[model samples]
Target chain A: EDKVVQSPLSLVVHEGDTVTLNCSYEVTNFRSLLWYKQEKKAPTFLFMLTSSGIEKKSGRLSSILDKKELFSILNITATQTGDSAVYLCAVGKSNTGKLIFGQGTTLQVKP
Target chain B: DVKVTQSSRYLVKRTGEKVFLECVQDMDHENMFWYRQDPGLGLRLIYFSYDVKMKEKGDIPEGYSVSREKKERFSLILESASTNQTSMYLCASSPTVSEQYFGPGTRLTVT
Candidate 1:
């Protein structure tokens, strides 16, 4: 069975702090791993990592995947209260386009 | 930009009642997915449609049905609503098999 696990189910950080969220997966025929941020209602796309040891970044957010290790990490620098939300990780299959999602990491950035 | 929309932001249904949740995407995406979100469980896929009229069962498809009669619209049906079915339902669409865009979720409550 394919499974995705996220560590540090919940975290508390102050503004301007840097936090790293981890996600590990065990899936057959893994094609890509994706990260999302959910604030209130919807989850917005963060990044999709398909290559090992390569980093994808946008502003204060960055992510990297280790395909060889079957894990991924999302880093947020200079965290703010607006960054408080649940971060999700999902793994996709190349053949079926199916995705298996992790339990998510809830981040609370205090002002 | 891709936009995904759901029929309702909140819904209340009684046990044994039939419920329908609708999703529409404006990007003419080839893949549409339905998932339920719960505390501690993250997102569990209920069903997915790769093309018009082509539907596939996802990880958690029991007590649910799906319809994709058109390219931009997908619907999820709860045959008989139960307390266990109360959850936040999310809709997502993808161009191929990656980088999914999500919609504002519908919170369903069965009492």
Candidate 2:
């Protein structure tokens, strides 16, 4: 069965502290991995990684995938209160382009 | 910009009542998906459509049915609303399976 797991289900950190969120997935015919940040309502796209090793970054957030290890990590630097949200990871299959998502990590940035 | 819109931000329904959730995507994406978000379960796929009138059962399709009469619209139906079905419903769309854009989500409460 295809499954996605995330580590550190919840985290609380100071405003300036950096945090790392992990996601590992097992699925047939891996195509891509995606990251999303959900604040109070909807989720916004963060990053999409298809190749291994190469990193995708936007502002203070960056992510990378390791297909060989069947895992991915999201790194956030210079965190702020606005960055407090639920981070979600989803793995897409090549055969049908369907995705399987993880439980997500809740990060709270304290001032 | 990819804009996925849900019909409501919040809804309340009585137990055993039939419920319908509507979603529309502006982008001419080929894939549309419906998912429910819970506290610890993250987002679980309920149904998806690759094209008009072509529906596929997702990981959690029980007790739910979907309609995709047009390319830009997808609707989820709950034959009988239950307390356990109260959740945040999310709608997403993608050109393919790579990156999905999500709606603001509808918070449904059943009594």
| Model 1 lDDT, residue B31, Cα | 95
User: For residues A15-57, what per-residue lDDT tens digits would candidate 2 score against the true structure?
Assistant: 9999999999998888899999999978898998999999999
By TM-score, the best candidate is 1
lDDT of 1: 0.95
Q: What is the C-alpha DockQ of each candidate?
A: 0.83, 0.84
Candidate 1 per-residue C-alpha lDDT over A1-111 given as tens digits, one digit per residue, 9 for 90 to 100: 999999889999999999999999999989999999999978998999999999999999999999888999999999999999999999999876678999999999999
* Model 2 residue B15 CA deviation in Å: 0.8
Model 1 regions lying over 4 Å from their true place:
none
lDDT for B110 in candidate 1 is 100
- DockQ (0 to 1) for model 1: 0.83
Q: Any runs in candidate 2 off by more than 4 Å, and if so which? A: none
Query: Residues B1-111, candidate 1, lDDT per residue (tens digit)?
Result: 899999999999999999999999999899999999999998999999999999999989999999999999999999999999999999999998788889999999999
